[model samples]
Target: MVNIRRIGLVATLCASVLSLPAYAQQYRFNYSKLYTQMKNNLEEGHPDVKVAFFFQEHKTSRLCKIDKAWMEKDKHYEEFVIPPSQELIVPLDDNLRQVGPLVYVNAEQGKTCDFSMVVMTKQPLSGEVSYQDIEQLLPQMSKMLDDLGGMFSSWFAPKVIGLTFEFDGVKQSAIQTSKGNTFSIDNGKAKVNLADLSKNESLLLPQTTFRVLPLLEK
Candidate 1:
């Protein structure tokens, strides 16, 4: 008989009749198992940082629900499922460039949802450029973060907020704070009132860098 298979395969009887389209295996995601595994893994890795996550797309994304009805009287079965290895992306930079190691999570659990985490290793802190010129300046910025954090506690604060203090060189930036009174960097200075800054003592201004720091309240 003339064997019409590929040369190499023909020697092996066409590789046992091509073996059922190379056995394309479709994975059925065990969502319960997968969600538990991912959550446990993240907790084990980062102990100190409390991670809270919310879904960008609720029902449409990972929380897809499918319902079916049977021929019996008032009988039906329903299930929610998502594809294996779905994408979870986060905006890493001011440019809004996204990066990911995505997965499906059990979002039905409310705040306790088993979210797919894309733990970013590190990112360059912006606005602190050349801050080494005045490394001590961080406490100033940190105070700003705390202040903004407090500010937010009082009202609905935006995730990204900014306060500036205008000096000769505008520290032009957004600052997150718990305090509602976010400082501003206007006219080359952190837009703080000199009267609120200090009615007690002189602010020994650091001359090394042009950016100013919010004065410590008396």
Candidate 2:
């Protein structure tokens, strides 16, 4: 006969393990060397441009009501900025980026504030670089990976969800899933693809900058 208590125990363990966050996986990559390569690429191409990195903080009005008077008095927004910096490692999953210096805000009440990184250039890129441009750059990134040897890939294959580029304050973004190399871009203003760009692990900055976001308690 099957032991009911043992089956229950097994079920509980499986549920607990499944509930953990996907970002909990220790996704390690060569942050330092990647940063160096990114810096070099930007300097050689856009010499005058600066890059800024930031994540959005989203909070709901119901949560704000806990401190209604104070939130109202402060005139906070539901969405706000967590600026960029060289030290920032762009989180593979947007939600996982919320390691904070959180601030309270009152923007977009009653809705969840979805946070994601915004990679911006101080000045617009000289011209639009499309998938073809990225394709050309692939060899450069592949070469960098090759130099790292097989050890890098043997451990894990890095996955990139997406990347957003801002040109003269206009936004263009691309998204990809773990299943394939195809990606979709928004606004159609930029022709870049995340799959091609993700190949270059070293592309990390143009002169990356950062800002801190505020926290709200529920």
Candidate 3:
């Protein structure tokens, strides 16, 4: 009787494990697809702008720069630079496969390069997703994931906690949001809480340039 109960319990556990949702496993970072979307968006949205995409180590206090050696290593580009002049598409190699790189959109001197950025991450959130402002968009984002699956969902599936924008070209950075609120990027970087920009749905606008740093789980 006891042996029979043990076997039954093992069978039940196996069933439960097998019944788990496969959606989570399906979620992935497809760099080619992501780059295509970003490229097309930038081309159609802002024809005069050029952008660079790279991963910045969070713990590094100093500014991040793309290394020439790494960029040219193995004939595989680690950093991607997209120019509006031509259709430039560089494939992401295995080294930075699943990492979400920071995007730098450039603007002509004294001009603002306005654009929208999608936050993507595969890591789990560090804490609870309780931001009331972003909470409202959860349902819509979920629907997007269901419809688009991993192709585009990676852009919006992650929970955004804090946002950081860094501007390097000009000394004084005048950053503005879609809500009309303005902020300055000190020392080429400015950290902003998502709660503060509740009314804004997008980041990056004219008269300044910046890089995006979205808070992720430690």
Worst 10-residue lDDT window for candidate 3 reads 6-15
Instruction: Return the top candidate by TM-score.
Output: 3
Candidate 1 lDDT score at position 119: 19
Question: How badly does each model clash, as a count of residue pairs?
Answer: 31, 18, 2
Off by over 4 Å in 3: 1-60, 64-67, 70-90, 93-159, 171-182, 198-208, 216-218
What value does the lDDT take at residue 144 in candidate 3? Answer: 26
Error of 2 at 184 (Å): 9.3
How would you order the candidates by lDDT, starting with the best? 3, 2, 1
- 37-107 per-residue lDDT for model 2 (tens digits): 23433434333322222112244211111111110113432322222222222223223223221222222
Those runs of model 1 whose alpha carbons end farther than 4 Å from true positions after fitting are 1-29, 39-45, 50-53, 57-173, 176-218
Q: How do the residues 35-70 of candidate 1 rate in per-residue lDDT, one tens digit apiece? A: 332342243323321111222233332321111111
TM-scores, one per candidate? 0.17, 0.24, 0.31
Q: What order do candidates take by TM-score, descending?
A: 3, 2, 1
Name the runs in model 2 displaced over 4 angstroms: 1-102, 118-123, 126-218
> Which residue window of length 10 is worst by lDDT in model 1?
6-15
Query: Per-residue lDDT tens digits of candidate 3, residues 48-164?
Result: 222323322234433223221112224444444543321223453444434533222222222221112222222222222233523443333333222333355445444434544
